[model samples]
Target chain A: MNEVADLMVVLMAMTNLILLGTARLTLGVRLVGAQGALAGAYMFAANAEHPTVHVLALSALIIVAKGLVFPKVLLRTLEKAEARHEMEPYVPYSASILLGMVMLASSVWVSSRLPIAGLTIPPSAVPISIWTMFTGLFLVVARRAALTQVFGYLVLENGIYVFGAAIAGEMPFLVEMGALLDVFVAVFVMGVAVFHISREFEHMDTDRLSVLRD
Target chain B: MTMYEYSCLPVVFGLTLAPFFLGIINRTKAKVAGRQGQPLLQAYFDLWKLLHKGAVYSRTTTGIFILGPVVGLAAIVAVLGLTPFAGCPPLFSFIGDLILFAGLLGVMRFATMIAALDTGSSFEGMGASREAWFSSLAEPVLWLSFAVLARLTGQFSLGAIQSEIGSALWAASAPELALTALSLFAVFLAENARIPVDDPNTHLELTMIHEVMVLDHSGPDFAFIQYAAALKHWVLASLLAGVIAPVHTGHAWIDITAALLTMAGIAVATGLVESVMARLRLTRVPQLLVGAGALGVMAFIVDIMR
Candidate 1:
C-alpha cells in the first residue's frame, strides 16, 4: 500500500515537471487533469487497508471533478480564449522546469525538517504535495495566459487535496467536500472571466491588460 | 580465467554488430513508410564499400582533418570496452570509469567539432556550435543520471553499478530508475543525431548537426566516422538497456541475447519516433535537453529522499 502511494506521488511529481515544461495550453490542461486523477488514486491507495464509504466517495468525486470535468471546462475556456500555447512566459519553459526541480528539492528539504504530527502517511507524500503546490503557484506566476493560470489554480487545489488525503484520518468529510465545491466554483468563475477578457481584449494575454489602465 | 575471457564478449559484439542495429533502424523506418527497405546488411555493405575506396583531401586541409575520425573512433572504442553488457562485466572497469565513459564521449565530440572547424566552412561551423551548445546542456543530465545510479547502488564504476542493478534495487526505487532511463534515452537520441533532436537523414547542411560536421571527409575517413557513430550509438544504447532491461539469467549467452534484443527494440522505437514526429525547431532543442536534465535532477532528488 505504501509503495503504491509512493509511486502515485512520484508520478504526480513527473506530471508537474511535464506541466512546467510544456508550452501547449491544452496539453498542460490534460496533464493537470491526469495529476488530479492520480491524486484520487493516491487517496484510495493510502487507505486500502480500511476502506470507508466517505473515502471512496471522495476519491471518486475527485477523479470525476478534477480529472474529467475540470479539463473539459479548461479546454472549453482555451477554445473560447483562442490560445493554443503559452508563448513568451515570464520564465522560459526550460528555466521553469529547472525552477521546478529546485522547488521539489526545497520541498523535500522543508518536509524533512517539519514532520507531520500523528500522521502515518507515505514518506514521499508530504514533499510531493508541497512540490505540487509550488509548481502550481509557479505556473500561475510564470505563465501569461489566463487559462494557463486557471490550470495552475486547479493544480494548486489538487495539491491541497493531496495534502488533505495524506492526512485523511484527521480531515473531516464536510471540509473536504466543501473544498472541492469551492474549487469547482472558482474554476467556473475563472473560466467565465477568461472568456470575457479574451472577447473584450481580443487576446488572452494577461500581461497586456495593463494597457487598459491609461 | 574463463570469466575474464567471457567479459570480452561485449567488445567483440560491439565491434561486429553495431552497424547491424543501424540497419535495423533504417529498415524499421522503411517498413513504416511502406517501402521495401534495403537489405539488413546495407550498413555493412556501405562500410565495406567506403573502406575499399580511395581517400580525398582538400588543398587547404591540415593533418587534424584526417586525425579527427581516427581519434573519435578510438575514443568510442575505448568507451565501448568500458561499457557493461546485459549485467556482464566490461573488459575494463575501475573506480571512476563512469567519468572516463562520459569524458571519452566529450573527447569524441571535441575531435569532430575541431575537425569541422578546421575546414573553414561556415556550415559545419554552425553545426559544431549547435552540437556544442546542446551537448553542454545534455552532459550535465548524463552526470546527474550517473549520480543517481551511483547513489542508488553505492558504486563509482559503471560495471559495478550495472551489476548491482537487479530486480532488488528496481523493486526498491523503480521511479528513480525509470526517470533515469528516460533521461538517458533523451541523451542517446541527442548524442546520436536522431530525430526530435536532429535528423540524421537531413541533407540540407543548414539543418544538419552531425552530418554537416563530416561533409569534408571522404572514403575511408568517412567510413571510420560512420562506424564510430554506430558504435557510439551501441554504447549509449547498452547503458540505457542495462537500466531498462537488466535480465540476469545467470547464463552468459541468454543475457547477451536479451541485451541485443533490447538494443534492437530501442532501434525500432527510434525509427518509429523519427517517422511519427518531425524534428523540433532549433530554438526548442535546448529546452528539450534542459527538460531531460530536469528529469535527471528529479530522479536524483527522489532517490535521495528514498
Candidate 2:
C-alpha cells in the first residue's frame, strides 16, 4: 500500500512538472485530468488497508468529477475560447519547470520540518500535496490564459483534497461530498467566465484585460 | 589473482563493443524505416575505413586541431576506467570520483570546443557555442542525479554506488531510481548528439550541434573522433544501464552479459526515439535539458524526504 501510494505521488509530481512545461492548453487540460485521476487513485491506494464505503465513494466521485467531468468542461471552454496555446506566459516553460523544482524542494523542506502526530500516512504524502498546491498556485500566477488559470484552480482543489486525505485519513463523508460539490460549481462558474471573457475581449490573454481599467 | 583479472572486463568490453552499439542504433533506425538496415558491423567497418584513409589538413590549421581528437579520446578512456558495468567495479575507483567523471567529460568538451575554434571557421564556432550552452544546462542535472544515487546508497564513488544498488534499493526507492535513470538517459542523449537534442545524421550544417564541429576532421582524425564518440556513448549509456539494470549476479560472466544486453537495449531504445521524434528546435532544446534537470532535482528532493 505504501509503495503504491509513493509511486502515485511520484507520478503526480511528474504530471505537475509536465504541466509547468507544456504550452498546449488542451494537453494541459488532459494532463490535469490525468492528475486528478491519479490523485483519486492515490487516495484509494493510501486507504487500501481499511477501505470504507465512504472513502470508496469519495474516491469514485473525485475520479468521475475531476478526472472525467472537469476536463470535459474545460475542453468545451477551450473550444469556445479557441485558445490553442498559452503563448508568452509570464514565465517561460523551462523556467516554470525550474521554479516547480524549487517549489518541490521547499515543500519537502517545509514538510520535513512540520511535526506530524501519530499519523501513519505514506511518508511522501504531505510533501507531494504541498508541492501540488505550490504548482497550482504558480500556474495561476504564471500562465496568461484564463482557461489555464482555471486548470490551475482545479489543480489547486486537487491539492487541497490530497492534503485533506493525507492528514485526516477518513474525512467525513458529508464534508468530502460538499467539497466536491463546491469545486464542481466553482469550475462551472470559471468556465462560464472564461467563455464570456474570450467572447468580449476576442482573446484569452488575461494580461491584456488590464486595458479595461483605463 | 582471478578477481584482479576480472575487474578489467568493463574496459575491455567498452573498447571492443562501443562501436557495436552504434551499429545497433543505426540498424534499429533502418529497420524502423521499413528498410533492411546496414549490417551490425557497419560502424566497425566505417572505423576501419576511416583509419586506413590518408589524413588531410588545411594550411591554416594549428596544432590544437590535431590535439582535439587525441585529448578527447584520452579523456573518455580515462572516464571509462572510472565507470562501472552492471555492478562490476571498474579499472579504477576512488572517493569523489564522480566529480572526476564529470570533470573529465568537461575536459573532453573543452578540448573539442577549442579544437573546433582553432579551425577558424564560423560554423564550427557556432556549433561549439551551442554545445557549451546545452551542456551547461545538462551538467547540473547529471550532478543532481548523482547526488540522489549517492544519498540513496551513501557512496560517493561510481563503483560503490553501482555495487550498492540491487533489488533491495529498488524495493525501497524505485521512484528515485526511475527518475535518476530518466535524467541520466537525457544526459546520454544530449551528450551523444542523438536525436531530439541534435541530429547526428543531419547534412545541413546550420542545424548541426556536435556534428558541425567535427566537419574539418577527416581520415584518421575523424576516425579517432568517431571512436571516441562511440566510447563516450558507451560510458554515458553504462551509467544509465547501471541505474536501469543493476544486475548484480554473483558470477562475473552473468553480470557482464547482462550489462552488454542492457546496453544493446538502450541503443535500440535510442534508435526508436530518433525514429519517432524530430530533433527539437534549438530554442526548445534548452527547455528539454532544463526539464531533465528538474526531474533530477525532483528525484533528489523526493529521495531526501524519504
| Top-scoring candidate (TM-score) | 1
Taking all chains together, each candidate's TM-score versus the true structure is 0.98, 0.97
Model 1, B9-92: lDDT tens digits are 889889999999999999999999999999999989999999999999987779999999999999999999999997778999
Clashes of each: 0, 0
- In model 2, the clashing pairs are none
For model 1, the interface Cα RMSD in angstroms equals: 0.9
- Candidate DockQ scores, in order: 0.82, 0.89
Cα lDDT for residue A161, candidate 1: 79
- Per-candidate local distance difference test: 0.90, 0.91
Report the Cα lDDT for candidate 1.
0.90
lDDT of 2 by residue, B172-277 (tens): 9999999999999999999999999999999998999999999999999999999999999999999999999988778778888898899999999999999999
